[model samples]
Target: MAVLAAIDIGTNSIHLILVEVDESTGATRQLRKEREMVRLGAGEALKKRRIGRKSFARGVEAIARFAGVAREAHADGIRAVATSAVREALNGREFVEAVRVASGVDVRVISGADEARLIQLGVSRGYPLHGRVACIVDVGGGSTEIIVADAERPRFLRSVRLGSLRLYEEFLAGHDPVDPNDYRRLQRHVERALRPLGRNLREYGYDVVIATSGTALGLAGADAASRGLPAGRVHGYELTAARLRALQRSLLRMTVGQRRRLPGMNPRRADIIVAGAAVLIGVLELLGRTALVVCDRALREGLVAEFLDERLERASQSGDPHAVRTEAVQEYAVRFGAGGEHERTVLSLSLSLFDQTRALHGLGAADREILYAAAMLHDIGYYVAASSHHKHSSYLIRNADLRGWTPGELMIVSAVARYHRRSMPKERHPEFALLSPEARDRVAKLAGILRVADALDARELGVVDAVRATARGGALELEAETAQEIDAELAAVGGKSDLLAAALGMRVTIRALQVERDVDQRAVAGY
Candidate 1:
């Protein structure tokens, strides 16, 4: 088992969870858990939309302390994420950099929508939620996240600036013992804000409602304590709306200090606990649910699950029919700003040629996959430079850390993409030298087809529709199926047929045959 640490720096608190995890399945047994209330979104920083000096210092110190504990536990990796508070803060990056230096950990600030998704992942992955349709409600200090998802995927997610701290500051700033009129105003404001959910609740009906974050858990903990139950046995805790309203009523009549005296109430959150309760009740009313299931799992567990999934995917990289490898290869191409339409065309034409010429090359599915990936990424090197981008393409393809495909397979794809344009493959090329005589021959034949494909789409206009390669006598005829006369494409075909001819040991011919229009928007262009 690997030791993993996940740190969640929220607007109101910083949380660290250390676990010995099985990375492949994201299964974990918790080792140590820590929380520090720093109120990173408190006071003037909220108005300024930035982390204040005191809060920033506190934030850094908390992360450093947590990180130290994680390292002391010999954790394999630490993922530190900052939520809504840092996202709205102008000085968020500056504070993040300070924390990085102090804690040796880079802080990741996530959007509210992403925050909701992570919370969903945490509940689904970290806890035993099964595969039931779940509506998760996560209430933080600075914002509340509402998500409708199943056990596996999120269907809808929303984040609102109506968290406990925001509600306290916005509607009940100076109210002590919560004036009856002020409480009514708060309730009306909450109802109006969440009214939009009536449509979503009807559209995506949920099987069960799950509540997370300190507010829901704190109240649940208090409820459990009053009933002589263990507070730590909070997960899967079920609380009904009527019972929740009873607790909210008790808090409404007491001052913040008096509320803190309640069992399971933390002194730091006593003031805004009523607002948290209000948000939860608002969600229950909107969804017409009687009870909510509280989950101790939240964003921290989500981060760990996501991190492990990525690592497992990359470690077992292959062009398996699952296409995980193909997806990763495309991500690299997109990352470098390759033209989409051109890449698709080249890939289509090259694959078509590979299929039609199957009798001649005798390459396996694995090699054909290498050719497909190469065609998709042939021109990505243009992001570095337009001239001789073929060389750049090879370098990138050879160096790409794709999920699937071994080093030898990567070299073949890179080599084929490298020779798509200008120069012919030679004995002295180091990348070519790495391949065996048989593999080098395969690369040359694939490169020959790619060269013709790239030339066919030189204009970046979607002109050619279908392509076929036929063996006739001592020559290989390459036909372009198109409705419009493709003089430019044919002319390009003439100039780039030398490599094809050499690979096939015969002359190559090109012709355009008129055909009906067949176009796909996603199939516009590729090189």
Candidate 2:
């Protein structure tokens, strides 16, 4: 047996693991797994495309602490890696040097595809797939890595920028009690982002799916999924999508405070649970798999295996073009300071309204995703020139080298961003006329929702909270829930809702609902 330690510095948190491995039997015993949320990707990480001073300090501090713990455990050698945020940060190298000096642990920043290969090694050692077709999915804070493996080697792999903390802060922040519509919208966004992967998964079918992440652990460990499991079975807990969705819905109904008190809920992950659910459910939907086995073994475990066995290493390089493209697009947006609170809040509102009023528009999940992407990228044109930014946005989006999107889908995202603040969609418009009839309609529908969402956050004053949309007597009723006055938001929505009204053939009415301040979790006994 060999004693070893591993560290993973992720976008959302930092992790350390100490383990003893028996080489002859290929069995491993985990002595300890420690995690702390440094949130290295928060603050300026995403918005400014660099690790902020405060977050950088916290990250270095966390690494030093993890190193100290490994020493206490008498670990032979500690291997560490930084994923997602660090690799993309401008000052990422600076922090890496600090970590080396403070902790004496040299940390390597691995690429998404490389991360997938390591994950495969880690999972195989822990679960032993037995040469069957299996899919290993590791959902990190800023990225999700998926690998399809036969008994010996990987068949295919892909990584996407759909992480729980990133999604939570970007799409559902400040919503104390998340609206059901927003949750559904987040699901659609994930589904859309993974649409290309869905096609690949269909081609290379698998016998089983495996997941490794805090969100998966939290969801699988919940009473709903783990109520009657055997002792020490958390590593291989089989969780059904239906049960996971049920837990997600239940969590959505409760606030952060209420969720923290629930048994099996990780208090550190309470806030980002919804975003994590999005990634899990998205993968499930894409694979057409009903359930996935949870693996407590993760990147850290993979790192240990790598140190002990060089034969475990596979895959060509650390990066994939598609994964890199996703990062580039996000970085391009932040370069213009386009991904502020206003853009994110508007995206949530747009998605909420689109989902709730689906009956009126007759749009499906794919169309809903277009709305979300548009909401995220709509304001990016302002980076070019403030005047007529909507037109410029259309041009910039169309010109960007986006990956994992078909030509038609890219055009749809471009069209939606274009029409977000401009004249109504018309057959005479040059770009609008290029799409097929169905695609054109989708663009119009998504753009209409985006208009209303943009209006709700007009001037970047987010007074609106939850929104519910329903059709009544040739009028669309949109009820908003907030503690602050929404006079400006309402006034802005009036002008912006014109396109929405025209698209749905109904006038829009904006009203307020009194915010619910309390979640009576008295029935929920604390753990």
Candidate 3:
């Protein structure tokens, strides 16, 4: 037997679960569970994209205490993962480093996609999904992850930015008793965001819907109390859409203080419960499902299951390490009508430039990979509209269901692709501004290189065969090997080299050199 502790660092709270796993049977027995409402993503922190001093302190203290508890329990191992709050924050790495110093545990900030995957894993452990197609919905403090799956594997996974705390802050925070106008606006926002999710759920078609997370459990408890049922164990409780709508209406009519006094209500969750209810009701209505089953297991429990699975050497159906990231990216690009000779040429040039300018850019292999993805997808926005295609590219990248990428990585790629053509990275752009200082710099550098590479193939005739970069005294020179004259490409480079010059802190000059080549080796190698 092995003892383990799993901590879920969430937007609204930090949760700890201690369990003892039997190696022989691969079964786990829960030892203890703890929750602290640190509200890491509360108020202006979410809007400003930074963790506040007070919240950061509270979060660190909570994790330290929890780590101490795990140590006291003689845990053999500890696994901690952070969700939307830390994942989206500009100072999220700062918070993670602080927690590590305070608790001696490294926190992994999971992407929305991974969060959804783990939620399904945890829910499946407690509630059997055998032979039944199920839709799992988890409404957290800062984001919601939805999954459509069967007994064998998940058919779809999606993470939306809407959550109880986020919705409250955005729409209903100021009003004690929700203003009618504010409530309508909130509903509209939720509906609009969930439209695509609704379509996916309809197409996948699930036999049952499952709801997890604190918000769901609290709402389920309240619903049970109202119906004169035992609210002690809410696990596996069936909450109908009609009853949920009624609960939402009643909660909205009451002030926070009044809601806090309700039977089975979690006093700590009173402020955001209404918004949570609205999100659940909207999802249920969208699926056209009459009821959803509440599961108490969520991310923390999922961590425990994963730990045990690793020890037992159990292979997960959906967790294939051999799957190629390029395959997923290529599929997504094709969906957006983005792949062709031009895109291929731009991708080759981008990789070549990134590799050749490594010393100047000071980037590593991981960043080079991000640049590869951004280059392949830079022009996908043309499918939407020719005008302002850069902006459209950013949106498509963010929304695409590309596997094997974290949310932060996707955001960086999106920002890089967005700035490949038009304006440089600035603090005014919300997407660009949301990134951390380090990430912003990375985007700027990668975008700068992308801009130059794209300009080299401006005419799309592939006039430039290859570019060799050499740094001189405070200046960079690019020699392009090609048989044809690249006057048009040279002019385009002149127009677009400003960003690169600023990034490298030097002047950039490019000239085409006449050369003969039997075949383009770089193009043939599929760079």
Q: Give a tens-digit lDDT track for model 1, residues 99-176.
A: 999989988889998999889878774343323478889999888999988655799999988788778867776788
Q: Which residue ranges in model 3 land beyond 4 Å of their true spot?
A: 314-527
Model 1 poorest 10 in a row by lDDT: 518-527
For candidate 2, write residues 1-527 as lDDT tens digits.
Answer: 56688888899888888766533212244556677788888754775779978778888998898899889888878889999989888888999999999989998999988888877766664563433578888888888889988534678878788887778877777687897777777878888888988777888768999988778877776743347543222556788989888887888889988887777777777888878887888788777789998876667767876775441121112355433433444445555545433565676678678768878889986776566557767877666677888887888778776645566676888899989885998888776989988888778778888998888777463445557888889999988776445677788888888888887778899877866321211111221
Candidate 3 lDDT by residue in tens digits, 12-102: 8888898765442232445677888888888788889998898899899989998999999999988999998899999999999999999
lDDT sort, best first: 3, 1, 2
lDDT of candidate 1?
0.79
Report lDDT (CA) for all predictions. Answer: 0.79, 0.74, 0.81
Local error of candidate 2 at 45, Å?
2.1
Best by lDDT: 3
